[model samples]
Target: MTDHLNVVLHPLVQHKLTLMRKKDTSTGVFRQLLREISQLLAYEITVNLPMTSRTIETPMTEMEAPMLAGKKLALISILRAGNGLMDGVLELIPSARVGFVGLYRDEETLQPVQYYFKVPDSLKDRLVIAVDPMLATGNSSVAAIDLLKKAGATNIRFLCLLAAPEGVARMKEAHPDVPIVTAALDERLDEKGYIVPGLGDAGDRLFGTK
Candidate 1:
């Protein structure tokens, strides 16, 4: 079985994440760091992608060269906060098909409310990757993945900058087949459902909303 949770402990990824976690990191700097770290995560997540060989001429010789086998990819951003994380991944995988799931959490119930959802066609043919910077309660992430599966995404992976134990447990219970890759796994979530030691709200930090 695939390891359900993967913490990218690469020194570079961890270093950048630390900088991102600081409270005073400027929006521009935070965004740049996220982009850099995101590219690294993108590299890690795609390491084992299926490959096929294609005939190609190198200088003066014809040879079979390896290339990705299936559809380029379907990158599903779990809206708002997810948008912050996707741009960096996009920079690395420019050919990937992009989609968005718009969900807002209701404070009282901490349930996800979907306002918008759209994804690429033939989702099952592509390796779908869902991006969300913070996996705090896992409610939004789980709901987003549920919707993606309903839309025909069979091969899916979850990517995030930080993950809480509660969120990781929630995802494992809900979608064990989908592996999760994150920069760090923090201790737990607070009463307000925020990840402890998390860099506040990812969307707010990314967009300067708060």
Candidate 2:
């Protein structure tokens, strides 16, 4: 993926991810960890956001204070696992707008088929961040980004909990302009298109299912 992927190696993030990866971690605990770690990832992803200054008076004097330069951000969740990450990001950026792109992978073909998509208007004026828990084959992530661009989102970033090498490569080839921020990039995708040594199905783990 060249230098497009940002693997957050913060100690706290890695620690929480380790616990989340364990097979015995309860669904409630896993969901909590994801929420917490997602906030940290959000911090990293927004680090270089464009900033400008605004004049403000502090009791005695007026001074220039830094403020976000662009329109309210658009947080697009690639459901249903993306919702887990989205909740945490929204905690930090409460004013950011939210949207959803529903897609399911064809197990046999390993391709993405979009079923639903709804996004905030004026995406071209905002910094659109797309969130999802796992980036496996990258089919769904790429497809989601495609839809976002078609809707007028020129600036976009991808946030994920875990990623496989194949998925990263796929995204790099398809959308080199979009940067990827992830907690950990795992080994590879297994035969079933699941990240090997991953935390298992993220949506199921987040919601607790077989």
Candidate 3:
């Protein structure tokens, strides 16, 4: 994966994402698919995590074993929709520290407005992976990253279920250092700022809201 973006096209991830994109899929099923797919995405994003070795005693004999190097990861959910992906990633990395960044879009300017923000301590020492289900307009995602940077987070990665060309370009321009990992990259954002061929409002669909 390049330092810019990594699109996970594994068969299982693609299959589940296809289900998520279908307009008729129910909320429960969509939630389940998101959880399953997030795990797969987690695997891809963490491929190069530093590793260390420790001596351990097995049932047979004492030997050196491999373990993750450095402090526990900080998983920063970008708000309500990010929670869907966060739960699944937490399942895989149960010991990870969790954080939240809440943002809502302004109807007038279509800009992101922060509502809440909290993150784990020593963000600079840990790998911070920001989770948001859909990278639609990239405003909120970029804003959340800004908060993280202000909080002293340097090592950061962005995880999303789907991304649009517009969103990717925006993120690349704003924070080229942070890599983006996603299941699929769609065509473009519609006039309303929703991803085209993208699953409808991720937060709304995940929570059965209008």
Maximum-TM-score candidate: 3
47-105 in candidate 1: lDDT tens per residue? Answer: 99999999999999999999989788999999888988899999988999999999999
Model 1: weakest 10-residue lDDT segment is 1-10
Q: TM-scores of all models?
A: 0.97, 0.97, 0.98
- Candidates 1 and 3: which is better by TM-score? 3
- On a 0 to 1 TM-score scale, where does candidate 1 land against the true structure? 0.97
Kindly report which residue stretches of model 3 are placed more than 4 angstroms away from their true locations once superposed: none
lDDT of 2 by residue, 74-147 (tens): 99999899999999999999999999999999989999989999999999999999999999999999999999
> Per-residue lDDT of 1-210 in model 3, one digit per residue for the tens?
566989998999999999999999999999999999999999999999999999999999999999999999999999889999999999999999999999998867779999999899999999999999989889989999999999999999999999998899999999999999999999998888899889899999999998
Candidate 1 residue-wise lDDT at 34: 86
Predicted structure 2: clash tally: 0
Q: Report lDDT (CA) for all predictions.
A: 0.93, 0.96, 0.94
